[model samples]
Target: MTTERREPDRNADERTMLEGWLDYHRCTLARKCEGLTDEQVRTASVEPSVLSLMGLVRHMAEVERAWFRRVLVDDDAGWIYCSEADPDGEFRLTDADTWQEAQATWQAEIDIARRNAAGFALGDLSRGRSGSGGEPFSLRWIYTHMIEEYARHNGHADLIRERLDGATGD
Candidate 1:
Protein backbone atom coordinates (compact mmCIF):
# COMPACT_ATOMS: atom_id res chain seq x y z
CA MET A 1 0.00 0.00 0.00
CA THR A 2 1.10 3.55 -0.63
CA THR A 3 1.77 5.61 2.49
CA GLU A 4 1.16 9.34 2.51
CA ARG A 5 4.19 11.37 3.47
CA ARG A 6 4.47 14.70 5.29
CA GLU A 7 6.95 17.48 4.56
CA PRO A 8 9.80 18.39 6.84
CA ASP A 9 9.67 21.44 9.11
CA ARG A 10 11.87 24.41 8.23
CA ASN A 11 11.97 26.86 11.13
CA ALA A 12 10.37 27.41 14.52
CA ASP A 13 8.63 30.29 16.31
CA GLU A 14 5.78 30.81 18.77
CA ARG A 15 3.19 30.21 16.06
CA THR A 16 5.10 27.34 14.53
CA MET A 17 5.77 25.92 17.96
CA LEU A 18 2.06 25.69 18.69
CA GLU A 19 1.28 24.55 15.19
CA GLY A 20 4.06 21.99 15.21
CA TRP A 21 2.67 20.35 18.30
CA LEU A 22 -0.85 20.51 16.90
CA ASP A 23 0.25 19.19 13.54
CA TYR A 24 2.13 16.32 15.13
CA HIS A 25 -1.01 14.95 16.73
CA ARG A 26 -3.21 15.93 13.81
CA CYS A 27 -1.07 14.16 11.25
CA THR A 28 -0.68 11.18 13.53
CA LEU A 29 -4.46 10.82 13.70
CA ALA A 30 -4.81 11.35 9.97
CA ARG A 31 -2.22 8.66 9.37
CA LYS A 32 -4.24 6.30 11.50
CA CYS A 33 -7.10 6.73 9.06
CA GLU A 34 -4.90 6.35 6.02
CA GLY A 35 -4.54 3.42 3.58
CA LEU A 36 -7.97 2.14 4.46
CA THR A 37 -10.76 1.57 1.99
CA ASP A 38 -14.13 3.28 2.32
CA GLU A 39 -15.57 0.14 3.83
CA GLN A 40 -12.76 -0.08 6.31
CA VAL A 41 -13.18 3.55 7.23
CA ARG A 42 -16.83 2.93 8.02
CA THR A 43 -16.47 -0.45 9.68
CA ALA A 44 -16.86 -0.57 13.43
CA SER A 45 -13.90 -2.69 14.41
CA VAL A 46 -14.93 -2.35 18.01
CA GLU A 47 -18.36 -3.91 18.13
CA PRO A 48 -21.26 -1.88 19.54
CA SER A 49 -19.06 1.19 19.82
CA VAL A 50 -19.79 3.00 16.53
CA LEU A 51 -16.24 4.25 16.73
CA SER A 52 -15.07 4.00 13.17
CA LEU A 53 -12.24 6.02 11.71
CA MET A 54 -14.78 7.94 9.68
CA GLY A 55 -16.75 8.58 12.83
CA LEU A 56 -13.69 9.96 14.56
CA VAL A 57 -13.07 12.27 11.63
CA ARG A 58 -16.62 13.50 11.80
CA HIS A 59 -16.45 13.90 15.55
CA MET A 60 -13.27 15.90 15.37
CA ALA A 61 -14.83 18.09 12.73
CA GLU A 62 -17.61 18.93 15.11
CA VAL A 63 -15.11 19.41 17.90
CA GLU A 64 -13.02 21.94 15.98
CA ARG A 65 -16.08 23.86 14.89
CA ALA A 66 -17.63 23.88 18.33
CA TRP A 67 -14.52 24.91 20.19
CA PHE A 68 -12.93 27.36 17.80
CA ARG A 69 -15.84 28.82 15.90
CA ARG A 70 -18.76 28.67 18.27
CA VAL A 71 -17.01 29.09 21.57
CA LEU A 72 -13.86 31.04 20.89
CA VAL A 73 -15.04 33.21 18.04
CA ASP A 74 -18.38 33.94 19.69
CA ASP A 75 -20.12 33.04 16.49
CA ASP A 76 -23.06 31.47 18.32
CA ALA A 77 -23.78 29.35 15.30
CA GLY A 78 -24.53 26.66 17.83
CA TRP A 79 -22.78 23.41 18.62
CA ILE A 80 -22.04 21.27 15.61
CA TYR A 81 -22.86 17.89 17.13
CA CYS A 82 -24.40 18.60 20.47
CA SER A 83 -27.90 19.84 21.26
CA GLU A 84 -30.69 19.37 23.75
CA ALA A 85 -32.13 16.38 21.97
CA ASP A 86 -28.78 14.82 21.19
CA PRO A 87 -26.38 15.65 23.94
CA ASP A 88 -23.11 13.76 23.64
CA GLY A 89 -24.16 12.91 20.13
CA GLU A 90 -20.83 13.98 18.74
CA PHE A 91 -19.56 10.44 19.17
CA ARG A 92 -22.78 8.96 17.87
CA LEU A 93 -23.00 7.60 14.36
CA THR A 94 -25.00 10.09 12.39
CA ASP A 95 -24.54 10.59 8.67
CA ALA A 96 -21.00 10.89 7.52
CA ASP A 97 -22.69 9.69 4.29
CA THR A 98 -19.50 8.58 2.59
CA TRP A 99 -15.77 8.49 3.04
CA GLN A 100 -15.25 11.53 0.86
CA GLU A 101 -17.96 13.42 2.72
CA ALA A 102 -16.35 12.60 6.06
CA GLN A 103 -12.94 13.67 4.88
CA ALA A 104 -14.29 16.92 3.50
CA THR A 105 -15.97 17.71 6.78
CA TRP A 106 -12.75 17.03 8.63
CA GLN A 107 -10.77 19.22 6.23
CA ALA A 108 -13.27 22.05 6.56
CA GLU A 109 -13.04 21.91 10.31
CA ILE A 110 -9.27 21.96 10.24
CA ASP A 111 -9.18 24.85 7.84
CA ILE A 112 -11.52 26.90 9.99
CA ALA A 113 -9.52 26.03 13.09
CA ARG A 114 -6.30 27.21 11.47
CA ARG A 115 -7.91 30.45 10.37
CA ASN A 116 -9.39 31.08 13.80
CA ALA A 117 -6.10 30.38 15.54
CA ALA A 118 -4.26 32.69 13.18
CA GLY A 119 -6.38 35.62 14.28
CA PHE A 120 -5.08 35.40 17.81
CA ALA A 121 -1.87 36.87 19.17
CA LEU A 122 0.67 34.65 20.89
CA GLY A 123 0.47 36.24 24.32
CA ASP A 124 -3.27 36.91 24.16
CA LEU A 125 -5.06 34.69 26.61
CA SER A 126 -8.41 35.64 28.02
CA ARG A 127 -11.83 34.16 28.62
CA GLY A 128 -15.20 34.96 27.11
CA ARG A 129 -18.65 33.76 28.01
CA SER A 130 -18.82 30.81 30.35
CA GLY A 131 -21.14 27.99 29.35
CA SER A 132 -21.86 27.33 32.98
CA GLY A 133 -21.24 30.89 34.21
CA GLY A 134 -19.07 29.43 36.95
CA GLU A 135 -15.70 30.94 36.10
CA PRO A 136 -13.52 32.05 33.21
CA PHE A 137 -10.65 30.43 31.37
CA SER A 138 -7.84 31.77 29.28
CA LEU A 139 -7.36 31.27 25.56
CA ARG A 140 -4.12 29.56 26.47
CA TRP A 141 -6.16 27.09 28.46
CA ILE A 142 -8.30 26.43 25.43
CA TYR A 143 -5.28 25.87 23.24
CA THR A 144 -3.77 23.54 25.76
CA HIS A 145 -7.08 21.73 26.07
CA MET A 146 -7.28 21.26 22.33
CA ILE A 147 -3.77 19.90 22.27
CA GLU A 148 -4.51 17.51 25.11
CA GLU A 149 -7.66 16.32 23.43
CA TYR A 150 -5.90 15.63 20.16
CA ALA A 151 -2.99 13.92 21.89
CA ARG A 152 -5.31 11.58 23.77
CA HIS A 153 -7.23 10.72 20.62
CA ASN A 154 -4.06 10.24 18.65
CA GLY A 155 -3.02 7.56 21.09
CA HIS A 156 -6.35 5.83 20.64
CA ALA A 157 -6.03 6.23 16.88
CA ASP A 158 -2.60 4.60 16.93
CA LEU A 159 -4.00 1.49 18.55
CA ILE A 160 -7.06 1.46 16.34
CA ARG A 161 -5.05 1.95 13.19
CA GLU A 162 -2.64 -0.78 14.23
CA ARG A 163 -5.55 -3.15 14.64
CA LEU A 164 -6.96 -2.12 11.26
CA ASP A 165 -3.60 -2.57 9.56
CA GLY A 166 0.01 -3.30 10.40
CA ALA A 167 0.91 0.36 9.73
CA THR A 168 2.78 2.26 12.42
CA GLY A 169 4.49 5.67 12.94
CA ASP A 170 5.47 8.27 10.38
Candidate 2:
Protein backbone atom coordinates (compact mmCIF):
# COMPACT_ATOMS: atom_id res chain seq x y z
CA MET A 1 0.00 0.00 0.00
CA THR A 2 1.26 3.45 -0.87
CA THR A 3 1.11 6.09 1.88
CA GLU A 4 0.09 9.58 0.77
CA ARG A 5 2.79 11.51 2.56
CA ARG A 6 2.89 15.20 1.78
CA GLU A 7 5.68 17.67 2.19
CA PRO A 8 5.12 20.44 4.72
CA ASP A 9 4.16 23.74 3.21
CA ARG A 10 7.31 25.84 3.02
CA ASN A 11 5.39 29.04 3.57
CA ALA A 12 2.85 27.79 6.06
CA ASP A 13 2.40 28.86 9.67
CA GLU A 14 4.37 27.16 12.45
CA ARG A 15 1.46 25.00 13.60
CA THR A 16 0.59 23.83 10.10
CA MET A 17 4.22 23.15 9.29
CA LEU A 18 4.72 21.12 12.43
CA GLU A 19 1.55 19.10 11.90
CA GLY A 20 2.47 18.44 8.29
CA TRP A 21 5.92 17.23 9.12
CA LEU A 22 4.58 14.96 11.83
CA ASP A 23 2.03 13.46 9.47
CA TYR A 24 4.69 13.04 6.81
CA HIS A 25 6.88 11.08 9.18
CA ARG A 26 3.92 9.02 10.25
CA CYS A 27 3.16 8.06 6.68
CA THR A 28 6.79 7.40 5.97
CA LEU A 29 6.70 4.77 8.70
CA ALA A 30 3.59 3.18 7.22
CA ARG A 31 5.14 3.20 3.76
CA LYS A 32 8.20 1.44 5.07
CA CYS A 33 6.07 -1.51 6.10
CA GLU A 34 4.10 -1.74 2.88
CA GLY A 35 4.06 -5.06 0.98
CA LEU A 36 5.64 -6.92 3.87
CA THR A 37 4.29 -10.16 5.19
CA ASP A 38 3.35 -10.49 8.84
CA GLU A 39 6.33 -12.73 9.36
CA GLN A 40 8.57 -10.19 7.70
CA VAL A 41 7.27 -7.41 9.90
CA ARG A 42 7.76 -9.59 12.96
CA THR A 43 11.35 -10.36 12.01
CA ALA A 44 13.85 -8.70 14.32
CA SER A 45 16.22 -6.10 12.92
CA VAL A 46 19.35 -8.10 13.91
CA GLU A 47 20.76 -10.29 16.57
CA PRO A 48 20.62 -8.87 20.10
CA SER A 49 18.04 -6.33 18.95
CA VAL A 50 14.34 -7.01 19.40
CA LEU A 51 13.26 -4.12 17.20
CA SER A 52 10.97 -5.00 14.28
CA LEU A 53 8.67 -3.16 11.93
CA MET A 54 5.59 -4.25 13.78
CA GLY A 55 7.25 -3.46 17.08
CA LEU A 56 7.86 0.11 15.95
CA VAL A 57 4.22 0.44 15.06
CA ARG A 58 3.20 -0.81 18.47
CA HIS A 59 5.69 1.42 20.23
CA MET A 60 4.47 4.47 18.34
CA ALA A 61 0.92 3.66 19.37
CA GLU A 62 1.90 3.75 23.02
CA VAL A 63 3.76 7.01 22.45
CA GLU A 64 0.73 8.61 20.84
CA ARG A 65 -1.44 7.50 23.73
CA ALA A 66 0.97 8.69 26.36
CA TRP A 67 1.51 12.15 24.93
CA PHE A 68 -1.99 12.82 23.63
CA ARG A 69 -4.45 11.06 25.90
CA ARG A 70 -2.45 10.96 29.07
CA VAL A 71 -0.68 14.30 28.71
CA LEU A 72 -2.51 16.68 26.44
CA VAL A 73 -6.04 15.51 27.18
CA ASP A 74 -5.16 14.61 30.77
CA ASP A 75 -7.25 11.50 30.38
CA ASP A 76 -6.67 8.50 32.61
CA ALA A 77 -6.19 6.29 29.56
CA GLY A 78 -3.11 4.16 30.02
CA TRP A 79 -0.69 2.33 27.76
CA ILE A 80 -2.30 0.17 25.14
CA TYR A 81 0.30 -2.60 24.85
CA CYS A 82 2.56 -1.94 27.80
CA SER A 83 2.55 -1.81 31.58
CA GLU A 84 4.79 -0.90 34.49
CA ALA A 85 5.59 -4.60 34.75
CA ASP A 86 6.58 -4.63 31.09
CA PRO A 87 7.48 -1.09 30.16
CA ASP A 88 8.98 -2.15 26.85
CA GLY A 89 6.32 -4.76 26.19
CA GLU A 90 5.24 -3.21 22.93
CA PHE A 91 8.59 -3.98 21.36
CA ARG A 92 8.39 -7.65 22.25
CA LEU A 93 6.12 -9.46 19.87
CA THR A 94 3.93 -12.35 20.90
CA ASP A 95 2.80 -15.18 18.64
CA ALA A 96 -0.68 -13.70 18.58
CA ASP A 97 0.45 -10.23 17.53
CA THR A 98 -0.26 -9.46 13.88
CA TRP A 99 0.58 -6.54 11.65
CA GLN A 100 -3.07 -5.88 10.95
CA GLU A 101 -3.90 -5.58 14.64
CA ALA A 102 -0.88 -3.45 15.38
CA GLN A 103 -1.62 -1.12 12.47
CA ALA A 104 -5.23 -0.74 13.57
CA THR A 105 -4.23 0.11 17.11
CA TRP A 106 -1.62 2.57 15.89
CA GLN A 107 -4.11 4.29 13.59
CA ALA A 108 -6.60 4.52 16.42
CA GLU A 109 -4.04 6.18 18.64
CA ILE A 110 -3.18 8.64 15.85
CA ASP A 111 -6.83 9.58 15.57
CA ILE A 112 -7.10 10.25 19.28
CA ALA A 113 -3.86 12.21 19.19
CA ARG A 114 -5.11 14.47 16.41
CA ARG A 115 -8.35 15.17 18.22
CA ASN A 116 -6.61 15.91 21.50
CA ALA A 117 -4.04 18.15 19.89
CA ALA A 118 -6.71 20.09 18.02
CA GLY A 119 -8.25 21.22 21.31
CA PHE A 120 -5.08 22.93 22.45
CA ALA A 121 -2.99 25.79 21.13
CA LEU A 122 0.69 25.27 20.49
CA GLY A 123 1.54 27.45 23.47
CA ASP A 124 -0.90 25.78 25.86
CA LEU A 125 0.57 23.81 28.72
CA SER A 126 -0.44 20.22 29.33
CA ARG A 127 -2.44 19.18 32.35
CA GLY A 128 -0.12 16.23 32.94
CA ARG A 129 3.54 16.30 33.89
CA SER A 130 6.35 15.35 31.53
CA GLY A 131 7.40 12.28 33.50
CA SER A 132 7.05 10.90 36.98
CA GLY A 133 7.17 14.06 39.20
CA GLY A 134 8.34 16.15 36.28
CA GLU A 135 6.90 19.48 35.19
CA PRO A 136 4.01 19.83 32.81
CA PHE A 137 4.89 20.14 29.11
CA SER A 138 3.56 22.60 26.61
CA LEU A 139 1.78 21.49 23.43
CA ARG A 140 4.62 23.02 21.45
CA TRP A 141 7.15 20.95 23.33
CA ILE A 142 5.09 17.82 22.80
CA TYR A 143 4.80 18.49 19.09
CA THR A 144 8.51 19.03 18.67
CA HIS A 145 9.29 15.99 20.78
CA MET A 146 6.86 13.82 18.85
CA ILE A 147 8.28 14.88 15.51
CA GLU A 148 11.76 14.09 16.70
CA GLU A 149 10.66 10.76 18.12
CA TYR A 150 9.01 9.69 14.90
CA ALA A 151 11.91 10.92 12.77
CA ARG A 152 14.40 8.90 14.78
CA HIS A 153 12.22 5.80 14.72
CA ASN A 154 11.55 6.19 11.06
CA GLY A 155 15.28 5.97 10.46
CA HIS A 156 15.24 2.64 12.26
CA ALA A 157 12.30 1.55 10.16
CA ASP A 158 14.22 2.35 6.99
CA LEU A 159 17.09 0.13 8.01
CA ILE A 160 14.75 -2.65 9.12
CA ARG A 161 12.88 -2.54 5.85
CA GLU A 162 16.02 -2.57 3.76
CA ARG A 163 17.33 -5.51 5.72
CA LEU A 164 14.10 -7.40 5.28
CA ASP A 165 13.64 -6.90 1.52
CA GLY A 166 16.18 -4.48 0.04
CA ALA A 167 13.45 -1.82 -0.02
CA THR A 168 14.56 1.68 0.93
CA GLY A 169 13.79 5.40 0.78
CA ASP A 170 11.01 7.48 2.33
- Residue pairs in candidate 1 whose N, alpha carbon or C atoms collide under 3 angstroms: none
Q: Report lDDT (Cα) of residue 47, candidate 2.
A: 96
Candidate 1's residue-wise lDDT over 2-21, tens digit each? 43434436676656666777
Question: What TM-score would you give candidate 1 relative to the actual structure?
Answer: 0.80
- Which stretch of 10 consecutive residues in model 1 shows the poorest summed lDDT? 1-10
Tens digits of per-residue lDDT, candidate 2, 1-170, equal 48888999899999999999999999999999999999999999999999999999999999999999888878999778899999999999999888999999999999989999999999998986466668788888899999999999999999999999998777
RMSD of each: 3.1, 1.1
How do all models score by TM-score?
Answer: 0.80, 0.96
